[model samples]
Target: GYILSYNGGNIVNAKTGEKLFAQFLPDEVIPILYRYAKEKNHALLGYAGNEIITEMPDDQYVKEESRINKMNIRKVENLFEALEPHPTKLLMTGDPADMLKAENELSEILGDRMDIFRSAPFFLELVPKGIDKAKSLLRLLSKINLTPADMIAFGDGYNDLSMLKLAGMGVAMQNAAPEVRAEADYITLSNEEDGIAAALEHFCKRIFKSKRLKFRMWFKYGLKAQKLLAQGI
Candidate 1:
């Protein structure tokens, strides 16, 4: 299973892609967003974060969406109705002022009931309050009776900080921002250099005290340096 929206949303069964739970834009916050969209000011733009709606191409899509708003800011005549029943999450624009606008206007409206934060550089997410990746991972661990010590989390972004901190072994990518790197237990190679594979190799070597296990498997597959080993004699 994997956490989305920094753990506010989740895919419970990874292989089959099952959704166990989700959070949405609260009712009180919607109207404020509606006013913001309708006013067409402060660049506070957004879209109805449902999957099907989001997949619709810009041209084929009926609603007028914004190119400036990186979220695609789907324009809807009836904002509430357009959001519909399955609008699990809301992806807001990344503009600093746009983010600030929501905070200033809906901070009190949302209060403790909602979560509004900048989990990434490109988008601001809205999820249920107290919902985060670490919390969900903990719940999943509880069911399996596995503690954080059994987990090895990998991350490369701001949203990953929580999980990285909570994991038994958190490995951050070389490309990760400085803050994310700080939260990691160890910094690995960059994503482009196969950081995950590299980290796993190191972890496994530490476990077995040698790379022999991997070499044995390689030998069985007829992909080994057998000549070099034999030359040692």
Candidate 2:
């Protein structure tokens, strides 16, 4: 269920295998949280901030994604096909919060794609006011020629709330914050039980090969190496 990236292994301490700087969240907020959590000796250390933006991007209203032409940005919708809803239903109903909930539900039935971006609570707090995963994803969508109705995201923490709500099929893990769960359209398996893999298999319609497939492929070669070592050939 863990999502490993190339940078993950780069930060580990050589001799001790201890992580030197391994938590999520933006660079600015991390030091403050670290200092506070260090003094308190808290196991779950992070920045619980005053302002957290949990809203989706205002892509529909804005035409241009970014003023900086140098950056290559695309809306999440455009990067991958099979992400947007059919017929592209644009419904208008109520207040700010209610409208978002309606949008989340609408996306689930209409769109058929979901992608997971797992991050810690601190990362969510790092989002500047008025900026969110939806906005970032929208940037991706704009670049790729897709809409917000095409993508889905799964999460279980505060950071995941905006992303989940904005995603076409925002799913909350069973072990998510109450606030976060409230924003989700569906609830899936717990993080500890290969939940991400299960969700991807079922919803994404992906064909998964067993982990043992690699072992089976290489076992004969490994045995040959062992035999050669024994013969000193």
Candidate 3:
């Protein structure tokens, strides 16, 4: 079974699913953690089938707003009521409002058959947590038979700093933290300002000029970052 981490939301019937994974993050803390991200207007990506589904016009919202608007309690309740009778292993994570709704509805429907377990917090931000991006990335590297010395990374946030520090070549954005900038081997423009483009252009001009690879990595990453930031919703 795939490892599941919770950001919010709830499980309806843990019995029906293989495991119910919940990360105990307070409803109040998410917004504060996302403050800089929200201000930057980043979009998150979700995979649907083979395609990536991104949020539209991403922006930060208060907990109350997330509950009242994003959660849509009545709609969630209806969905849970509809799905509880079936046996489908669905993995989910979200906000408190939705989790409570699922818990209450599923408990009424499934009763003692349900098995829900809350996972410890994997604090991606604020260093010194049980599990995080660095650990996860190291796991990924091991799976791919690679090491930190072989990696080149690009990122712009607190959570990414650790990997940036470890990677052989760490690229930081113009808008990234001062600490990140200091650690980076190179600095690119802000995501919105064709930072990736600038970096790729430099890379192409220096290293891959004769290869004639028209597509640029910097442009690609920069545009991607901008798109992510914009669609964070």
Ranking by TM-score: 1, 3, 2
lDDT, model 3, position 64: 26
Ranking by lDDT: 1, 3, 2
Better of 1 and 2 by TM-score: 1
Top lDDT model: 1
Q: What do the candidate models score in CA lDDT, each in turn?
A: 0.63, 0.43, 0.45
Give me the overall lDDT of model 2: 0.43
Q: Least lDDT summed over 10 consecutive residues: which range in candidate 1?
A: 59-68
**Clashes per candidate (backbone, < 3 Å):** 1, 14, 16
The residue ranges of model 1 lying beyond 4 angstroms of the native Cα positions read 1-6, 16-18, 37-80, 84-86, 96-105, 210-233
Give the alpha carbon lDDT tens digit for every residue of 1-233 in model 2: 12211112113444575543232323343344334323432221111111111112233211111221122223332211212222111112223353344335433532233111223321111222233455555555665577767876887766567678777889888888788888988788887777777787777543335546667767978899889999998
Question: Candidate 2: lDDT of 166?
Answer: 76
TM-scores across all candidates? Answer: 0.65, 0.37, 0.40
- Where does candidate 2 stray beyond 4 Å? 1-127, 204-233
For the record, the alpha-carbon RMSD of candidate 3 to the native fold, in angstroms, is 18.3
Best by TM-score: 1
